[model samples]
Target: MRRDKDSKAKADRHALLAAAALQDHLARRLRMPGGPAVQPSLEPGAPMTLAQHLNLIPRPPPLLSEDQWSEVHLRSRLRQDSANECVICKEEFQTGAQVLLSCSHTFHRHCLASFERYSRAKTCPLCRAAQYQKRPITDGQDLFRVKCATRIQAAWRGHAARRAYRELRRHNPPKDERLRKKWAAERLQEENDRLLSKMEDEVGDLDSLFAELDASVAKSREVCDAALRPLAARLQQGLLREAEAEAASGRAAGRLALVESDTVAPAVACSGQQHLALQLGRAGLGVSAGLGAVAGAGAAGAAGSGGGEGPAGRPASAAAVDWDAVVARARARGTQDCPICLGHISRRGNEGIAWLSCTHCFHIDCIMAFEAFELASGGTPCCPVCRSGYRRRCFT
Candidate 1:
């Protein structure tokens, strides 16, 4: 009978604890006056916080520092109204008032300043929305200064890179991998030596040849000058005479104009048409003289002994690439397949078009693949089909 009682007591204790837990859960689901719903305790015997009991506790967001808040206040202070009014206190400007405008609504600077200091809140006190001022990046003199600084930094970096390259070149010698470069350099040096010697020998020969040629040219020039000097002198004399005649004629016209003006006034110019005709004729003569001088200068330039008559530097015509011939050669070399698709060529018309200088052509996808491959190889692209030095226009 005693064992039976003990077992029954233990079962009653467990039943009581289960009942307590159930009561706590039920209390959480039910709301209480002046407070949130209660929550069941995580540890049965532990003390519970009010939030834990109410299940209404929220995770806090990040907090801003006082300095950041001060900056926000400063930005807000920039938008002051003409009539300064305190938004929070609703006071007329009895003292110095700073207005703050955010989201098309104005606020008193002191109101925002107080909230910023005490509340640690980024939201507006009025609407509970995020506070922001119209703080656009200024395109002022400082911006130009910043841009100039960036360019100067870039130039400095370039100069440093070049200096580094030169330093490395000066300090480092050849490695095993650079044997080919060393050999090329040695070979180039020998070639340069030979070329120098050959040039010296040729220079001596050229000097003699040029001396003879110079003498012949000088003699020919002297003969030509002797023959043409008389003609040039006569032409120069004729030009001077023409110029003198023009000056005399202009002076005569000027005199005539003065006489005619003295004879008539603008109000009584009924018979001044003859004088106007003479003035027009003189103006025509002046124009003719200018044209004549221009023509004479052109003729003199052409006839001068200097070789300025020779052609100036003109670009050579680009050599045309024979697409048909290139296609034929590619076909002969058995490279007539699309490299990417590995599809056989159907016909040449518009199936693929080649770049002007290259032997390869392909579908658009193949060209893009070739471009990627070329980028990987870190050099100019080879032909996609035959690995020749060729490229083509790619249009999808």
Candidate 2:
């Protein structure tokens, strides 16, 4: 009986200890800050773990600072207006009693008081500005004033934000746009100058080529003239001999005729024959002189036609190009247009005007282009207007 009694006592002690431990555990789980009460009965599927039980505990809402509370009350007190509207209840103020928040929103005094007491964050209903500890309300009118002031503050902040946005938008683009336009203009000017320089270089090259061609043509003509000179001289001499023989034969025949005429004395006839012979001799001399003069004139004409030497014995092609004469003729045409291009001529040295031997004028570039086309077509360069051969004479 004693042994049974001791075992029963030990089991009872263990039971008491187990119950106390469970109670302590329950108390600890329930002791969370702002936590909800836990149920006495455990759910079936799984027992609550310590971590899961702790997670179920609610966290208290964050408290506002004293300064924040003071600011909200001060701004609210200053926002009074006659037309009081309650933002929380969405109703007009009938008793001239309202509350305001630092965010400048208005609400009825009763509504704000209830909201401050119950709201988790103690913030304004409309603007969500945090409210701190409550203050003693002196009067309902003051609350109304605060509400008006808060509304005004909120409106002011909105207005400031809008103004800043507008000002920012207005002032931003001109600097970037000005830079872009300036850069573009500079690039365009550079391109124009480059093109002008390239054109000038091309014109210079063409002028040099024309000069070389003129020189070559002049040399070829000189060679031809030199080759033909001896032949021309021999031909002239043969012509002179033929003319002399013809004159001599005619003189002899005239004298014989004078002798044969049958009406006179011998001495008179002899004198008449002598006078006829003298006249015939003078006529033959005149004929010979005339032949020489004719031959000389023909030679001079051929030399002139073949481009004779100019001043200082320079070839005609090597002589100074008569740009002045070309200009004058171009002006006489009464229009600034080049006949070949039918475009206005600049008369500037760069325009490269060339004049034909016939004095017809064209732009040098135009003439060169046409000549190239003609050469490509297996033809020679000639005057478009007069169908005359082109001569490289009037260029500088």
Candidate 3:
């Protein structure tokens, strides 16, 4: 009877409600018979935390923290709501006797009394709470709110996950691995072929251009050589004529030396020109007489000695220089080639004409280039035509 009263008092004491759900107190350290108090660490490994060492289990859900429990009236909520039917009696609330526990589950009062009388323990059949508070009401408002919150959270989280999935899709590569590599290889090969073709075409064009230039040069050289042949023959003829004239002059000098100053030989066998000189000689005196005498003797020698005539009908003794005629021809040939540069000397522009003391003419630019070449070679500049010492003057 004493054990039964103590058990009833213990059950009543455990059933009272607290401000919030009561968590189990931490276990106290154990003191062995041979040593001081020691906290047990049943778990293994280094740097184990106190909870991990104790190996605690997690709390049940709705898992509200102590700070989050402020608005909730634990006792009032327990009294206000419970299951509509009693689980123990298997009857509805109107079945004459019903009980509400702190866990908000319902049971019949006589059913609990009969259960406690026959059983040693006081566990509630509905929730299996060993001890709990009783109230007189039943409600389902909080349960409904929890279910709605769960559904809303689930929907929101699902939407967020779908959005994340779409964003991740952007990372997918357009081509498969093998195809991407194949395309890269093909591009490389095509570029190489294009470059090789371009290089070959350029080389062929370069070779053709060089061949054309070489042919043009050879043709121009042949034309120049052909043109020079007639000019060469003309030059040779002029040189021979000059030599003959010099010989005639020398012969005239020799004959003049043989003539007597006072005697007038009647049978002079002279031409009209010789007779004129003889008359002048006889009439004149001193140096004038000597000049006339020499002239007459020269005319006689020239007429008697037989020689081929040069150029036109003229006395052989006076071989008038071909210089003036050549200069006039050059001036008339306005677009004539320069002897130095082989470029034309035009009369209309800055180049106009330039001349040397030797009577050689060329374009001003050509003369200047020739002068530069001579200066570089450390030699005196000269006319390219006659090779005479150059004394240059410009017309424009």
Candidate 4:
């Protein structure tokens, strides 16, 4: 009987050990990373494990409950003011068409219904107040709400973006327009002053240039007067000699006319003597005038030579000489063209003939025209062929 009891105890102990070993093995397999999946199939009378029972229990719904929605709806209606606009739709409040949250935020009924169904969290969109309790939401009503909310939210977002942009523009800082204008005026004034200064400098330079030119002209006149003094003295001596020779010639002509009066008839002799006297008188006058002019020119030349006053004046005979006649006489010797007009000298008339001291001849009209052109072009009248300076009277 004791052996029978010992055998029964051993059996019970072995069974306990085996059960413990099986439990240990199952726990190890479950904890392993790559362990094969153990899917136990339960028989009709088998009791479920804790994990299986937990898995079988139903999960709470993801959306807001009917009671919570109804409470939200009731609150929204009570707080709905005609003056207030829906936050989601941005439309004026409709008496029973809006939802007011426990957090004092209001939205359109359709907007709130959609938020509750599609929102990841069961909280107020504005205040973030959580919906703790839940109830079933009907599919038909939720579907309609989601569609309406989608359209409203899109419009609201666009309106918000535009409003924000407008606010930013209105609050922007003003530009310093007055400062910019002041700077522009200052720059203009500075530029004007700079130009004025430059013009003043140019004016001063021109004044100095004119002063120098006047001084140079005065000095050149003195030099010319000094150089002409010797020539004037020679001209005076030549004029005195010519006057003596003319007086002697007049005496000889009167004697010859007297000798001829005896041989010819009394009427013819009287006429010849009268003619001879007239000719002598004219010759004497010419000689006297020429002497007077030479004396005056010599005196002026001598005075200017000492004081460096001005250029010497030409002798009256020199000034009165018919240069055109001399040129015509010279042209008769050779067929020469006028340098200015580039045409052969015309013997028919003296209208266009001009003679220069340098022996160069030109058409009177051409030289006069050229002189006027030269003066207009800021140049002195000079010989066009030789570029030599000549007294302007030479052309006359």
User: What's the lDDT of the predicted structure labeled candidate 4?
Assistant: 0.50
Q: Write the per-residue lDDT of candidate 4 for residues 1-396, one digit (tens) a residue.
A: 999999999999977866665554455436656543453333222344333444432223344455767776566447643245666667655344544454446666687788788886668777776653322223323444666799999999999999998676445533678866665676679799999999999999999998998888679646754554455345435545654565566753542322222212221111222333344345643333322233222222222223322233222322333555645665675747776545566643644455543345666545544553454344555567756443222212
For model 4, the stretches where C-alpha displacement exceeds 4 angstroms are 1-175, 250-396
Model 4: colliding residue pairs = 65-135, 76-100
Name the best candidate (by lDDT).
2
Candidate 3 at 130: error in angstroms?
A: 99
Tens-place lDDT per residue, model 1, 38-90, is 44334223345444444443323224455654565555346432134446666
TM-score of each: 0.19, 0.23, 0.21, 0.24
Instruction: Candidate 1: list runs displaced more than 4 Å.
Output: 1-144, 177-396
Please give, for residues 258-326, the per-residue lDDT of candidate 3 as tens digits: 232222232221223334344443454333223222323333333334234433322233232243554
The global C-alpha lDDT for each of the candidates, from Candidate 1 onward, is 0.45, 0.51, 0.48, 0.50
Ranking of candidates on TM-score, top first? 4, 2, 3, 1
Candidate 3, residue 316: Cα displacement in angstroms equals 34
Q: Which is better, 1 or 2, measured by TM-score?
A: 2
Angstrom error at residue 219, model 3: 1.6
lDDT minimum window of 10 residues, candidate 2 = 263-272
lDDT of 1: 0.45
Q: RMSD in angstroms, candidate 4?
A: 26.1
